[model samples]
Target chain A: MTAAALPRTTVDRRPPLGGFSLTYLALEIRRVLRNRRSLFFILIMPAVFFLLFGLPQKGQNIDQANSAAAIAYIMISLAVYGAMTASTATGGAVAVERAQGWSRQLRLTPLRPPAYVATKVLSALSLSLLSVLVEFVVGSIGGVRMPAHVWLLAGLGAWLGSLVFAALGLFVGYLAPAENVMQFMGPILALLALFGGLFVPLEVLPHVMRTIAKFTPVYGVGSIARSPLTHDFSWVAVLNVVGWTAFFGLGAALLFRRDTARV
Target chain B: MRTDTLAASETTGTRTPAVLLRGLTKKFGAVTAVNQLDLRIEPGEVVAFLGPNGAGKTTTIDMMLGLARPTQGSVEVYGLAPTEAINQGRIAAVMQTGGLLKDVSVAEIVRMTASFFANTRPVDEVLERAGIADIADRRVAKCSGGQQQRLRFALALLPDPDLMVLDEPTTGMDVEGRRDFWNAIRTDAQAGRTVLFATHYLEEADAYADRIVLIRKGQVVADGTASEVKALAAGRQVRATLPGADEVRLAALPGVDRAEVRGETVLLHTNDSDGVARYLLTQTTARDLEITSRNLEDAFLALTSGEDTDLEGVSR
Candidate 1:
């Protein structure tokens, strides 16, 4: 009506590809950051628990020679715990979205389909990395310090752990019916993480349970993460962790895409 | 099916249609949600699509909005393929659920969605237009159902799109809310946007739409102005109290299609019962006669009444 600026309609028709990517990323980050509960899950609860659990058990609890080595093992094992947290959070979120038709709404939007899976996995990775970073700082203050190399190893293990469980979480998110998402997701992750040695070391498991754990993805993630702490850096364990992550991620993505075709 | 012939047919007073769908069919597995359907909508017009539950109105809207693909035929919005054009940011739709993100506020939702269009209406003006300005700060999840509908209206108005398609926009709204919502739509139509709406409330369409199109079993059975459609519902009915009325003679009269004699009341159904009543008054000793014409409800019932609707295949 008055002397004015250019209207936004045509201006919005095409932003650069990067801008669209960032928009999708921003929307996801914004939603996750808005709730106090997600903040607690993302920052406080994991970091505090990792510190409380990692300090006292740093050296004497593991029978390892050096405190650095024992601390690394604990840090690596905690990656599995981080993965479990992501799985539970994301699984619950997706199931809630399904119930409230939020997933259907997202499907209708112009957001690229692959971006949905990619964004959640990456967000979970970033969060777990932050959690492990906090745990390392706390471990240092609590009379456990590692060489710079071990710190770098902890970051990598944390990210890899995030991917493995995020993919698992995505699968469970889709497969569980909306009503029982909590009931199913919690027990499944708890049992798998326990057997993978987050709550109990693999050395303490019974013979049958210990053997069965070798085939599980949690075992793959935990063993790889633990190798970083022990400075073992087993190539086979690393490959197994990465391989299962890709397999689960792809399977979950295809399932998500197929279910949304109607939506 | 020929566009040129249809265009030729279009130019002889009706003008080129704003939308045309020829044999629009969409099937998911074995369910043919939108069967082969042919439909045309014109510019500066409002059309209401009416059908029973699971009658494929939402499926048809989905195809038209380019959310889903057609299995057998094609759909065009203003002569452009719906999918490609909508992705390019042309037509705008207000869907069920309002398509509003729960975490975002009403203002943020409008601002983000409006960024997708060029020559978009101003954000503040759209806020006022959708009547959500008072609670623009409210999260979409926190708004009342009707306020949520208005926020969606704001989003649809952002692009100032040539065509606006709404599917069950007023489903969970209160009466005044529906009124305010349609009032905003009427303003959009006044701005020359072609408005297409789907509703189970026959009266909503009757009040706002310039024309009503009723679909049954995935096909268009009636499409015309309200009165014209009403006239097609076996037209009007005329009942007369005639003194020993000659039922056979009246049944045989011009323009009178059917007649029933019930005691003193002689009932006549015709395409033009008014004319029939005039003729009857002059020709017989009919004491008291009442004539009534079909309304949109009657027209809707008449068209959908014949189709086989099992409501089996459509999901919600």
Candidate 2:
């Protein structure tokens, strides 16, 4: 029999970018949002850290004008930490998906690899935005006395900078075994945060550690987020973020291709 | 561009074969999984790929689905590359297991799959057709093996594909579940969809497939209608107790396919059981003669074990 009789439900195949649909993104985000336990920790921990470390000081001998500027600086650092955790956590769920054969199932579909990667990045970024917003709100309630524009710019900078971590998460998600990925990720991210000066001021760190902090992936994001309030912008920070983004993004793309090819 | 390719496939007003593989080979290190396999399946034909475990059925199916590249040769679906056919939504597959996410509801995953295609059947309609409508709200992890297989079926149907490739679609299902799943598949096949399913169950191939292709060592050993294939391996067995029966002499006898002499008991596989039995009873000191027809399972073993007569001409 000829295929002419088959009900031809054909449509123009979308281009790679066109394959990335809002419907898919919304569904993925909805699934990610269902893990409320992770969301609770990601959102609450930064605020709690801000209350403990940045809340106590009234008039400290810091480089900034007043305790309020120092508090805003600390709040942005913690927000960067929160955003990193949220985005990486979101992106790292790929390890479980891969382990479950969902990635292979997706390879059978019309969805192109580029579209899949795009959806993943956007989904992770969306969660990062949420984490940044939560920190900003907590900072607001805790009497962070920055100009409104600084709060907006700093929050946007932090959320956008977390793209580097999103790429890192995908790379690790594709590389690490699914069962112990999170266990390795938690300590690794905490160390990056500590060394990158998201927890303590870089000026207070020992000379050697301060030098090492500038080279960490978190340093560029933290520096950019705080630059709005402290006027500490530098081309080095931009180069660091771009360089790591390319490194991790290329690694993720390669690993994803390898993973799909074998399965 | 699209119509041009479609028209090209309609040579002499006959469409291209639904699936065609030529000299397809796949190797993993020192192991050869599929060895120069060639097959051509016409549209609307429900063909069962029959083989035992480790017979390279899954490897062939994987190459056909373009999930793995062939080490050599080509795979075409409706005259297009397998991956191209998939991109056009002409083909979809229900893999054996582990395709569904455990935490997602059945209906939700179905909708998500529907979003992957440019044009698709309604998600609810596909779910209903696959017979999983009642359990649409159930989480996949809570569903039984049969329910999850049905869910995979629902996902495959979303693209409204013209060809469905299933790899052991009913592997873990109960007998009744197998019956229901095949019933659904039969209905879909009756709608003029070309289907290629890999199964190790002889009864499943006999009962469901219009044609069966039996494979052994990654090569087609038998390809014919169920009855024809059965006829190829069709015969009777004759057994008799005799002192020092010569297996070579009995195997050379007229109509005997294979003969085995074990101590005093001699077993002979032959089409003319009466002739073999008579000779053993009358011409020798044989006693306690017995004859039995070969069942499909026996036929399966004979065909797959390379013990059957040369069938290269039978399938052609």
Which structure among the candidates has the greatest TM-score?
Answer: 2
Using DockQ as the measure, the top candidate is 2
Model 2: number of backbone collisions? 0
Write the residue-wise lDDT of candidate 2 on A119-223 in tens digits.
889998998899899888888888787788898899988999999999999999899758457677989999999988998877788999999989998999999
lDDT of 1 by residue, B163-204 (tens): 788889998889898898889888767767778899878888
TM-score of chain B of 1: 0.87
In Å, candidate 1's interface RMSD is 7.1
- What tens-digit string does per-residue lDDT give for candidate 2 at B1-316? 0112122234535657788899989898988889889887777778889999988999999988888899998999888887788888788899999878887899989988878877788998998999999999998999999989989999999878888999999998999999999999888888889898999889999899887888877877777767556655667778889998888999999989789989899999876788888898889999999987766676678778764355443333
By summed lDDT, the worst window of 10 consecutive residues in model 2 chain B runs over B1-10
Least well predicted 10-residue stretch by lDDT in candidate 1 chain A: A1-10
lDDT of each: 0.68, 0.83
